[model samples]
Target: MTTGAEPDHGFAWPDVLCAPVRSLPEHSRLWVALSGGLDSVLLLHLAAFCHRSRVDVHAIHVNHQLQPNANETEAFCRTQCAALGIPLVVRRVSVNIGQAGGNLGGVEEAAREARYAVFEEILGPGDLLLLAHHADDQVETVLFRLIRGSGVAGLAGMPRARPLAAGQLVRPLLELERAELEHWAREAGIEWVEDPSNADQGYDRNYLRHTIIPGLKARWPGLARRVRHSAGACADSEFLNERLAERQWTECSKGSRALSVPALQALTVVEQKNLVRWWARKRGFRPPVVSDWSQVMHDLLEAAEDREPELREEGFRLRRFQGWIHLVPEQPEVPVSPVTLLPGEPLHWAYWTLTLESVANPESPSRPIRVSTRQGGERVRFRPEGSSKSLKNWFQEQAVPPWERACLPLVFAGSGDAGELIAIGDLWCSEQYSGGAPAAGWRLVVRRECD
Candidate 1:
């Protein structure tokens, strides 16, 4: 029953839409994510009216069948798009909102995942996915992240534009108020479906939107706008942090992949912690809490040089060997025995596998190579001209940690009585079995690090 003439409200929808899309490249295929809601309806109408030819406005509605009238909602969206002379794509998805632990967050996250999956599948490269997120939603997100003690990245709320699989997603209405969108819809005589669950306080976002945000806004009329500003500031700080982290990573590491432990140890404790945290986030690992990070830095950098150091957090373990740190999965001590490999058979291990292939070379020495687990006492003669040295001494000289030594695959040559250690992969390779004359083809292929 709302009317456009109710009040001026000092805002206009046409201006809102034009402002964001003004800078967008002309003739861009814009896909508007329509939820059969007022905001999306207004967005579709405005885009169709303004840039019908230059911008190909397509509507996509995801039917999350959580209500009895889900089919009706899809029909309404299709009709609306048809009326606007735009193409409509309706997708039906079933959301499993169960009553298990983490079910509340899980349901929302799963629905988001499902929606994005569909979007990626349908959207072509260079297309723009437009979302109807407004300033109010950004405010709520900032508050949610604040309650969870999130860092700057979380507090920054959603970005206006971010890269997805095939295309980029843009939240054009993020700078506008929700009330302005409603006013625009009323002026255009647009009809939209009402989702009853939005009013139901069972969901956390609904609870905040209905009960908490209104209360806060009542006391301070521009509370949402102020929080949005704070989010912008946080986003700026986060950007600076990322730039600094990139520079520090380059200066403190030898390769593009991992940091050198000695270089990391040279920095102050604060710098080291920042570098590690930045590295973890860049690698797609969840950022640790402040306390957890303190512990991780202490264990990783400050531990005795000879002592094996390990730090475990959320299925990931960071361990130090010599002057290098590696992130790996926490492995249990599963008993693995050496099994003879046939010509085409692959020897599987916890982390890697060894594949042996035979090549033709008459000059190649016929030596028997036996694969076996380390038994704590074994000598490997690396070269035919060098004296035989204990495996322990070789690992120490190579800077391999004591904990990782037992896990390395040890390859020995010579049968039963003449069996002698020959080569190892990713650890140390014996020189005795290394040299061979090349014929048409002669090579021993061993695949290591297979679980």
Candidate 2:
């Protein structure tokens, strides 16, 4: 066990709570993410000691089941909270860490997902979730992201506060060192659980904390503090990047959801790349390498307007159509068939399907039409008096996006082999076929759309 003499002018529990609470609302309920560790124990104790009136404190402990003593850790947290007269919420989460990515990243990410899920469930609207991450953790996180070739945003490490589902998550001790939390816990006679995994060198974080950080600290005793400052600078730089990205998005975006091709092409190459990266990030897509962005931009901007340009990277497809770029799934292409629909059955398409049923006739002439992909040299005869037109030419006339033209499901009439193509969904229909009057005749009814 490590022990140290208390500092003379150190900011204690009351001082920490009072400083942050002056800005918060009067009836804010703060839930501490207590992991039965020194940092969290100290945080919980501090929250209880101060702000007991205006703030309601609750402790949440998540059992990841990675360690054998996870149960003991939960019991210790419960006991500690009970002694402090604070309510304790224990959540046991089982994670299949091996199936995610089988690395430390996978394990940590799965555990974190489970932990946050429980935290969100316990917290109500406007309640705050307080985490116990400290300055040393922030420094280590920045180093880790740097080694992994992260961008400025990732190298900034964790934010002090962020909005979550139920409320906001705040890291109060982000300015405090880890050693200070241990010192405070010891001074208050608080017992904390020690997980053996923290010392295990197999994990990258443990290796950094136990081996790399100690070596660096030996050379420069304030290395963690310096790295924390560096992280703050990186965060400021990232904020500028974000602001520029937002501005680019405003200039380049078409609708509320997508970017306009002409607007995107008008920008410089660097601005175009930034706009694409920003758009991907905003749409919840993972950031890819510079090479990936290069290919996407080249395909989107340099490819021929009539050609369907698609580039697949990192489980997403950037596709170019008639003056537009759409992000879609990079899943295996499933072949859909143009077949006559039977009652109470579903027809499968690229990502969605259509179901047919019997229904009464409405105001307009309701028609049963077989929708299918446009076949080469296929001509649809509208009515006995109207002239026949090529399906491809008709699609172009309707201004349908070029990429979707070939994949549109074709609908026909009658059974297996004796069906004539009638109507294509949102494209064209044979004027010869009409659901006139619905008197015992086959009426095509769109049932449900499936993905």
Candidate 3:
């Protein structure tokens, strides 16, 4: 860690500037996201001088390794934190530039995602991560979203505080303008590194910051405050949209994981779209982005009964099965050929796990048990001495989705055509293989992942 000029304790800070940092939400520890920039450097000083005595104050610097002087900036952050007697953690991340074509927007987004991932990983309960996003940054963000055709949620701008991982992320300087923060930093004799990329107008944000915002500021003079008000209005609208979606979800849902097709068809197209987006977000997945929602909704809601229509998204898909729409996660590949299920060992198949355990004073099975996916002609015997039914017929009777039937594990007591299907995934198990005392003297336990 290198040393720098310490903050001037004698310089009096304005009450408006200090109030945001002083009146933080209840937290056990405070962390400053130090970027070695003017805004972040000033934020670190404010956090130290205002809350260091009351709570544990620390700093984290994420090195994106994008610019030529990335290492120098990281070193500067270390030096500043060391001078203030605050612990600093430096995380170096490799930003993937494969998606960044000729522009810097992709790189910016990738670095932001990586930085937030680090923050999410380090934050714990009662920890508050302080960001240095000022009013100027908010204006840029809102304008950028507007240019990109973003919805109300995107136009709402960065929140003042929100839950991140197990902790909270707070931007105390969001109400302060960039010029205000820089003026105070220079007044207190603080030092910071100037990133060279900020000067390049090649990046979209840089172009906005240097070319557009300056002119807007000169023309309006109160552009930041006006933008803040508009952003606040958008935020309010987005909140109401979320609440409306929640209520509509409760009305149309068939169960906790699915929606009723008939119930959804009764609602307006806009409501349907909003509910689906809200559901995907609630399940921790990005919402599906389609060129036309009306056509998608029509196919899902009004398609023929024989046709299995579905909307696929990242991580999960929404499929109309029977009378309900099920949100199913993409299952992993299962073994195509027969695999021996040894006693006391758990076998993982797709999203399901199969385990065979021997009962007390149990007798050995008549033959080796194995597990595999359905191989066309298959039979399942619910009883040891009763009649057997075809696997296809049983699945149809149970109303199991076709996509799921292809991956469900078929556990058998023997091999080939003579094999007796003892268990069907986690849905069914033969009496001989289940219960307190089985004819085979063993228990076949099957479990499916919750995700």
Which candidate number has the best lDDT?
Answer: 3
Ranking by lDDT: 3, 1, 2
Please say which candidate is ahead in lDDT: 1 or 3: 3
Number of the top TM-score candidate: 3
Q: How many residue pairs clash in each candidate?
A: 10, 9, 0
Comparing 1 with 2 on lDDT, the higher-scoring candidate is 1
Ten consecutive residues with minimal summed lDDT in candidate 2? 442-451
Q: Could you give candidate 2's per-residue lDDT for residues 200-297 as a string of tens digits?
A: 78888888888888898889999877987788888898788789889877766644345678888777777777666676676667755665565667
**Each prediction's TM-score versus the true structure:** 0.72, 0.72, 0.86
User: Which parts of model 2 are misplaced by more than 4 Å?
Assistant: 1-18, 21-28, 52-55, 329-451
User: If both were scored by lDDT, which would come out higher, candidate 2 or candidate 3?
Assistant: 3
Best-first order by TM-score: 3, 2, 1
RMSD (Cα, Å) for all candidates, in order, is: 6.4, 6.7, 3.7
lDDT against true structure, model 3:
0.87
lDDT of each: 0.72, 0.70, 0.87
